[model samples]
Target: MAYRCPTCSPDIMQARETIILVPGLLCDDAVWEHQNAVLSRHYDVIVPQLTRQDSITAMAEYILEVAPERFSIAGHSMGARVALEVWRHAPARVARLALLDTGVHSASADELPKRQALLDISAGKGMTALADVWLPPMVAAGRLKIDIALRERLYAMVERMTPEIHRQQIAALLGRPDARPLLAQISCPVLIGVGSLDQWSPPEQHGVMAADIKHAHYDVFDDSGHMAPMEAPEAVTSALLKWMRDDRGLCK
Candidate 1:
């Protein structure tokens, strides 16, 4: 059986704008796979490869160069950092913004040790073992017991990301900026969400970002963690549909 979002259909794509989706650390299409199918039904969707640069700022510039003159951005985790950079560099180009399971702060010096350790582990033992240690924390702890397919999909995605790509993205995350200062400057409609159990980027952190954006819509998926798009796809997709259809979402 094929799944199509109730409000989304392939016929709706004509003359629509583009929406670029950016994935986080060790994430690729699998991160946006669900949202892409539903949302792309209405908009021209493009999921860019985020591995070409080691800095969020550079990555944003690269995306802007290739993206349509005006487009929305949906970025998760580290990709959210890059989206902020995009809005900072070219505010006029982004029609709407969605930041999922991400934060507005810089990594603490203490976080460096853990980031480096993940890199070292992946380099030494390979991505499968790294996925063994990692894939669990990405979802609500309860998900491991109930969702075998989600767990396997995440592990497979991580295993496909090369060690060098993982290291590049990790380094980019470790040295990323505190985006709080720029949050107030976002003039476009903003959508922010996080899993209630997201330790990597807690809901409270997204609340802070939403506080600064005058028109931000926020949500917390109780059944999810860092990977809300996968753990709670139906909920996330519905929220994204509302965001895309609302008149306020297209306002500058």
Candidate 2:
């Protein structure tokens, strides 16, 4: 379903083009709360729920099935990977692409066991305990201490998800396709962003992706972590605005 998040911005104008925002693992519409509020003013923005699928290919297919004939698409974390899959399947249908705080590599050697550790936590102590252990490291070191609201929102989102949903997403990610080969062949405008202090998917990882994709705009949100859309909303939004703009200056 399309998520038009509640916004203080004036009632949206008639939008001309569609923009799909894909949330990361264990995330919901709240993750794109800020961008949805602002971007909806100009485009037909929708945040697709990735909760049902057990594989990246399935998630991508879901988005493509629901999306417009042609649309600008952006994804955060695992969502970014899904966006890549979408592009991989139907590049001609994507008007523009944006990838934030994500990676293109397949599962690393140590990834499965590390992810299993969190799975074990959720299975045993429950989602709340898993959130306490897993969420902190995902953000910048001091972020949670200072941004109590961000911390709470993220925890609440994770807690709302059941262990089975988490397992399905993990399964999806573990079996994700290696997208590096597709990077050099992308013909559409691309935006790649990451947080300066993003420990999970560091800036260097994105820098390499930028190097691979021709003319991809690479941005780094300083003082932000893995959650760039939430942690650095303004900068991320601005970059997306520019990336989505065409010669006529609209998302289409």
Candidate 3:
């Protein structure tokens, strides 16, 4: 639990308190740089490098080792899986959670073939080829036509990781625990966001998660894909800020 400051309002402290941000697989600090810049003005934010670990449990444990005793957490994609595990291991330490373009179910047998195919392509054609197949579907419609720099940046972010990290992360994702049962047990605030065009993690998935969790907030960015934070930065950042300021336990 966060200790209230004598000089600070409970509301202010809750909104502007320490926060931990987790990046998606193969992504680093750059993934969250946009939100961090703005959130840091009021919130004490930390974006930990997540490439060192593979398993979600191990990754969450490492974060617990480095994070403050209690703070809010926001994560995207694979990082969001780690966030769920973090809450599972230490619910009292988490003040709130934000999951973006993510899912709570375990890796399905149906997904394995697709994932293996990606891995095979990565091993054969190269990481650039891997990006070509993956990145196109991650952005909003017409993004490639208008956002050359953003596309290049996303490619660069994925390119930075080695084949080893890719293999490790994929393995970790395939073995992640099913988090559906724990949703109702969450005592802290919850926020789930996804892009309407996000084929990987459709809005329906988030809607289901939100319905199960008490006072959970759900958002859908109509003009975005999987990368809503980058595709619709202003809207995403605005919603996040508002979620922090408004009722943390506002259900429905």
Candidate 4:
């Protein structure tokens, strides 16, 4: 069943296409807050809570379960990986795809111990300390230091998540498939983006993704970090709007 915003008029809802906004690890709908609010005006937008699923495939399945028969899907960080998995399972169902601040490769050799270190923090010090340690690196250094409201918002979002959730998501990421091969196979329009200062999943990574995907468009959110949706909402949302707008010729 298609989930229309409760506040939308029947005609408006019927005229719009559905779009799923997937949040990253330790992230909730708030990560896509600006996009969801703006896009809902012109499209039927659903921001699913990926907190329950432990694996990327499971998360993709959950999205497919609640999603409409056909829709555009956008995901950030770990959520972007889930989006690719969604297309992997149901290409015909995904009208378009946007991957923001994420990667398509499997986990690195040293990724586990590093991830475990954070999990250790979560287990020992609680989510706040985990947020303190984890969230700073996720944002641009300048923003983390200067954007008081942004830092607090990100911290609050992370603190809302449990250590178990963090553990599960890390496991999902570690076990994630090598998605590079899936790129050339993607038939729908694809948008690959990253923040210019994104240290974790840098713009260079997305550039490579753009090259592999046949119909991919690449973008970099200037002066932003890994959290582009939060740090550069306007640029991210604008790219999504253009990607979904058929008249803009992005699909061709």
Local distance difference test, each candidate? 0.84, 0.89, 0.83, 0.89
Per-residue lDDT tens digits of candidate 1, residues 31-56?
88999999888788888888767888
What digit string (tens of lDDT, one per residue) describes model 4 on residues 148-188?
Answer: 99988998899899998998999899999999999998877
Candidate 1 vs candidate 3: the TM-score winner is 1
How do all models score by TM-score?
0.91, 0.91, 0.90, 0.92
Question: Which ten-residue region of model 2 has the weakest summed lDDT?
Answer: 1-10
How well is each residue in 14-98 modelled by candidate 3, as lDDT tens digits?
3347778898877888888788898888888988777777789999999999998867888988888899999999888887898
RMSD after Cα superposition, model 4? 4.7
Off by over 4 Å in 1: 1-14, 249-252
**Candidate 3 worst ten-residue window by lDDT:** 243-252
The reply for model 4, stretches above 4 Å from the true place, is 1-15, 247-252
Error of 1 at 190 (Å): 0.4
Measured by TM-score, how close is model 1 to the native structure?
A: 0.91
- The digit string of per-residue lDDT tens for model 2 on 85-172 reads 9999988788788999999999989999999999999988899999999888788898899999999999999999989999999999
Q: Give per-residue lDDT, candidate 2, residue 221.
A: 96
